[model samples]
Target: MIEFKNVSKTFTAKEGTVHAVKDVNLTIPDGKIYGIVGYSGAGKSTIIRMLNGLEFPTTGSVTINGSEISSLKGKELREQRLKIGMVFQHFNLLWSRTVLENIEFPLEIAKVAKEERRQKAQKLVALVGLEGRENAYPSELSGGQKQRVGIARALANDPEILLSDEATSALDPQTTDEVLDLLIDINKKLNLTVVVITHEMHVIRKICDHVAVLDAGKIVEQGPVLDVFKNPQQAITKRFVNQETSSASLDDTTVVVSELLEKYPNGLIVRLTFHGDQAKLPIVSEMLRQFPDVDLSIIEGNIHQTQEGALGSLYIQLLSEHHDSLQGALEYFNTMRVETEVIKREQ
Candidate 1:
């Protein structure tokens, strides 16, 4: 397991001192896909740097397994680094090197035999679905292929932990999903603990088992992926969750709601939130069947599948001449363990 104990970092530059990270405490379990999410300059890079021993913390300590990373030096630090592989945002491959050669670079630096490294690189090329592109150079590959090479290179040393730093920020939406799916494949096949740092929340929803939300140099929120998505507490976290919960913006949601209100002025806009197996249950159909006197219309709804489980958000307008039926439907949702919120009641 990796533990960050009261960790904080500061920089003494021309502008005096700046606290980059403030008292971050986190524990990442072994073999779990963990994500650290934040906007630009939220101390994410600092934490990654500290993980690889690139920078020492000003206070507290970072420990992985049994080693104190901040105190390691020279040979100790170098050896510890070999156990952690890092995939960069940019491909960061040697422009002159072929895909096979790039994958062999790490082993070459460690002074492994040329024949042995080449053999390992060939297997990795196939593992990352770059079998035909092994001889191709960085320039010859697409953005996604280049990242595949980067991932293959990171695994050259067969590290137990893989760190990805904005690895898909440059790719298009489809390519991003492809890359994320590849990472998930790698995680399951190797049982490697994966750490992904990015500003995008959909990335977390797609791959991470657990997530930590950073804002203004502190971890304002964190938990299992499903729990966080099901109930985001902080404003920063809600902003992130909204990115996956629905495609519509708040303004768009409001506009649709306004139109719904105009049509069904006495309707109650009920928002239903459920997680995991609740998505498969026949709660909605049952509600409709039981409440035959009421009218139910779906406004907007989506079920997002996370690495941990599934989370769904559904907005339905309930209308009836009598208010009792609307209230009865709300009570039925409560018994089904669905979180319900009345978005608007125009009675």
Candidate 2:
């Protein structure tokens, strides 16, 4: 387990002192995939660095298990670092080294015998699906393959924790998904604790079980991935979530809702959120069956799967001759555990 207790970091720049991170408190549980998301200058990279003792905190403590990493120095820090492995965004690999050699680099530094290192590196090569490319140098490999080599190298030490600092930002969407899937597989196979730092919401949505949203060096919100995606509390977090699921901004949603209200003055506009089993239900069909007098039109809807389960949202407008029917429909939704909000209702 990793705990950040009121951790903060500051740097002295030529422009003066800059607070990179502020009184941040976070707990990353063992054997879980956690994400830290933020845009440029949000201090997510700083947090990842602090986790592996690459950067020390200016105040408070960053504790891994029971040890405070900030206080460790020299050999102690280097020894502790072997327990945490890091994967970089740029896929830092030696161009002159082949895949097998790159993966064996860590083992070599650990003073393992040549034959033993080769055995370990070969195993990692198979683990990361680089079997046929073991002899390929970084220059001959694609971006994703390079990252695979990076991952294999990071795991050579058999570290308990892995830190990914924007590890997939440089890849295309398809390649990014592939790398993310590999990470997820490694996590389950080895029960390795993974901490990913990225600005991309898709990364968090794809594999992270938990997430923390940072803005201007402060964590605005943090929670289980499903909870945060379904019900984001901060503006920045909502923006990120909406980008992945809604594909529209909140202002855009409002404008669309307003136009629909103008076109159908008597219609009721609502936003419905469904999760897990609720997402699989034919609620709209059932609503029409029960309320034959009402008509429902979907303005926008999207459903996507997460680590937790399927989560979806729908913007709908209900047309009815009677207001009581609409009220009954909402009550039914409530009882079914479908979260609903009235976007526009007649006074």
Candidate 3:
């Protein structure tokens, strides 16, 4: 397990001091994929660097298992670092080295026998599906393949934890998904604890079991992926979640609601939120069946799959000669564990 206890980091420059991370606290359980998400300058990279002792916190502690990484120094820090491996966004491989040689570089630093290193590298090559490319240099590989090499190298030391710092930002969407899936496979196969730092919400949605949302050096929100996605409390976090679902912004959604209200003055506009099994049920069809006197039309809707399950949101217009049934319909939806909000009622 990794714990960040009141951790904060600051950097001093000729200009002045900058606080890259604020008083943040987080716990990442072992064998699970955790994500730290934020925009540029949000201190996500600082957090990842601190994990392996590459950067020390200005205050508080970063502890893996029971060791406080911030206090370790010299040989102690180096030894502790060997247990934690890092994968970079740029695929930091030696251009002159072949795939097998690059993966063996860390084992060489540890003074492993050349033959043993070769065996380890060969095993890793197969683990990462780079079998035929073992003799190829970094230049000969695609973006996804290069990242696979980087991942294999990071695992050369058989580290317990792997830190990925914007590891997919440089890749195209398809390549990013490929790398992400590989990471998931590695996590399950090796039972390795993986921490990913990225600005992309899709990355979080795809693989992370838990997530921390950062903005301006402070964590605005953090929780299990499903809970955060279903009920985001902060404006920044909501924006990030919307980005993944391709949902409209609050203002834009309000404008849409207003236009719908103008077009159908007697219609009722409602917003529905679904979580888990609720998203899979045919709630709209049920509603129409229950209230045959009322006409229901979907204006806009989206359903997205996350690590937890399906999360969906929909905007619907309800029309009826009798308006009282709408309230009863909403109450029925509430009893079914679906969140219902009447955005606009007949006026």
Candidate 4:
């Protein structure tokens, strides 16, 4: 387990002092994938460095498995570092060493026998799906292959904890997914405590069980991955959650309203969301039947598969002569545990 108690860090420069990290308190459970998400300059990198004693905190304490990391120094700190391994945004491979030789470097430092290091390195090469490339130099391999070599080298000492600092940022989308799957496999097989730092939301949704959102050197919101994505609290958290790559922006509800008004000129437009067990598609049909005078049309929506269950959003327009019955129908959905928000009305 890893615990950060009121941890803060500051850097003094010629111009002024920079507060890189605020008073962060977090508890990372053992044998689970934890994610730290933030944009550049959010101090996420500083937090990861503190895990392995690369950077010391200005105040507060960092404890891992009952040992205080800030208190250790010299050979004691170096000895402790062997039990924790880290990977970076870049592959960071030694150009002079072959894949097998690079994997053997850490074992040599730990005083493992020469024959044992070779055998162990060979096994790891097979584990990372690089059995045939063991003799290749770093320059001869692709980006994904080089990262695999880094993974093998980090596991050479059998560290219980693994820290990944934007490990997939340099790879393409397809390559990123492949690397993420490999990390998931490693975590399951070795039960390694993996902490990943990245700004990509897909990374969190893909493999992380728990997550923390950092902004301006402080965690604004955090919890289980599914829960945080479903109900993000802070403005920074909401911005990350609602981000999209499409040409249209969904941040403004007016876009939805304008589209509805352009298509259905004389109807009631409402936004419907379902959480937990109330996310059944039959609710749409049921609402239409209950209010026979009302005509409903689904405009724009999508169903997201969350860890809890299927949650969905629907932009619906109701066409009817009686508006009072339509209003009651909205309340009916509310009583049935489905959520409704009125976007626009056309009388």
Candidate 5:
């Protein structure tokens, strides 16, 4: 397990003392994909730097499996860092080196024999689906190919923890998904712990099992990816969650709801949220059958899958001559464990 206990970091800049990180206590269980997401200057870089021992925490400790990394000196620190490999954002490859050489670079630094590193790099080249491109230089490979090489190289040392710092920020959407899928495969195959540091919430939604939302160096909200998506507490976190949501989603359906309300002014508009298996249930159909006096119109809906399960959001307009029928239908949905919110009630 990796842990940061009451960690904080400060810097003496040209202007004044700046606190890069403040009172962060985070735990990352072994063999799990974890994500730390925040905008620029939110201390994400500082946190990762401290984790790899490149920078020490000002007031606390960073420990990986009971070993204090911050206290280590010289050789010990170097060895510790080797156990944690970093994948950079810009594909920081050697201009002259080919893919295989880039994959072999770390092992070369560790002084592994030339033959041994060659064999290892070859195997990694195949592992990352770069077998045919092993001899291609960084300049020749595409963005995704270069990232694959970067990943292969990070795994050259068989790191226990992989730190991906904005590794996909520069890639297109399709390539971003491809890289994320590769990381997931690597995590499962190697049983390795992966820590992704990104500003993109979509990156967090795509790969991370657990996430922490950072703002101004503090953790505002965090939990399993599915939980946070279903219910985001902080304003920043809600904004992040809303980014991945469809424009017609329940989180930001103001315009859609307005149009629906204007067109069907004599009804109640509600937002329904379904968790896991609930998303698959025919609750709305059942509502129609059981509450015959009510009329329901499905507006917009979407289902998002996370590492945990499926989270579904739907918007519907319920119309009835009687208010009790609408309330009864809502109560029925409540008993079925579907979350409901009345978006706009007829005035």
Candidate 6:
């Protein structure tokens, strides 16, 4: 329901002009949690701000629900913003206000009746599992609870979409999972489209069905989360995926593979990646029976769960006394549709 077409944003600083977002085009489907991941200065935050009309592009257009958001201003933009809710890394709650008051603040700004606002706020508190904390101030709540209040306040106007900007970055791992589960529930129950911008891969892996990998103010890769994670085509994408999987670095794997090559010139060391039901295959055992001397040594691996299925990778040393047998095993791997790369031995 959101589209960015040839959108570019430039900032004029004393040093020079900076292109925060450059010719970035993307489409976010409705009723899905979409993630934009990048490092500090990758312009991910700028992309999300454009959705709420909080930031406008220097050139091109941003269309939300079929209307150009950049063309709106004043009352027009304010009215449109009500349909889009946002939560921040920090709770951003008014410390002096009680939980009920904070949740009611947005309603008050919208000029809802006092009694109606109170009732709406009460229901929201219950929705976020903070019913008894209605009277407690923000200072009394834990990080996760404070975020729940932020969520309740954001939903005061019954927004159709939610923008989460590093929503769980400041919390502990336990608290992060709690907040993520809450977001997933809210998305399903409310049928709300979500756009989450964060550097953490765990956030994307947990909830996002679609993802875009950003680097230097440009999108290097974008696709279904599982597909992107299974076979990353870009270096930046591989770096992030590897971080989440915590797979041993390619350099380290290369070192071990190189040592094996020195000992056995005829052997081949290949990296293999398996996904979905393929992970359960008895392919390795079957291969050993077919070629008695072919040895498969798994150096490092991990199984990552995505909405689609399980994805696993392994580095193996395939040993055979003859070159013909080694080539035959490589061909067998190709037939299984398993991704494999030969580790070239240095001359």
The numbered model that scores best in lDDT is 2
Clashes of each: 0, 0, 0, 0, 0, 0
Candidate lDDT scores, in order, read: 0.91, 0.92, 0.91, 0.85, 0.90, 0.89
Candidate 4 error regions (>4 Å):
244-282, 303-347
Order of models, best TM-score first: 2, 1, 3, 5, 6, 4
Clashing pairs in model 6?
Answer: none
Give me candidate 1's TM-score against the actual structure.
0.95
Higher lDDT: candidate 2 or 4? 2
TM-score of each predicted structure versus truth: 0.95, 0.96, 0.94, 0.87, 0.94, 0.92
The candidate that wins on TM-score is 2
List clashing residue pairs in candidate 1. none
lDDT of 4 by residue, 101-130 (tens): 999988988899999999999999999999
Scored against the true structure, residue 68 in model 2 reaches a CA lDDT of: 93
Tens digit of lDDT per residue, candidate 6, span 1-347?
99999999999999999999999999999999999999989999999999999899999899988999989999999999988999999989998899999999989988999999999999999999997889999999999999999999999999989999999999999999999999989999999999999999888888898999999999999999988987899999988987786467667766877888898787788877788888889877777787787877877777777667877777788887777778888788778877777878777
Give the Cα-based TM-score of candidate 2 against the true structure. Answer: 0.96
lDDT of 3 by residue, 170-285 (tens): 99999999999999999999999999999999999999999999999999899999889878899999889878864666567677789889988888888788989999898878
Off by over 4 Å in 2: 247-255, 344-347
lDDT score for residue 128 of model 5: 90
Native-vs-model 5 lDDT? 0.90
Q: Quote the lDDT for 192 in model 6.
A: 96
lDDT of 5 by residue, 1-347 (tens): 99999999999999999999999999999999999999999999899888788899999999999999978989999999888888989989997999999999999989999999999999999999987888899999999999999999999999999999999999999999999999999999999999999999888988899999999999898899988987888999988887775545544467767877898777899888888999999999999999899998877888887777887888889999988999999999999999888876335
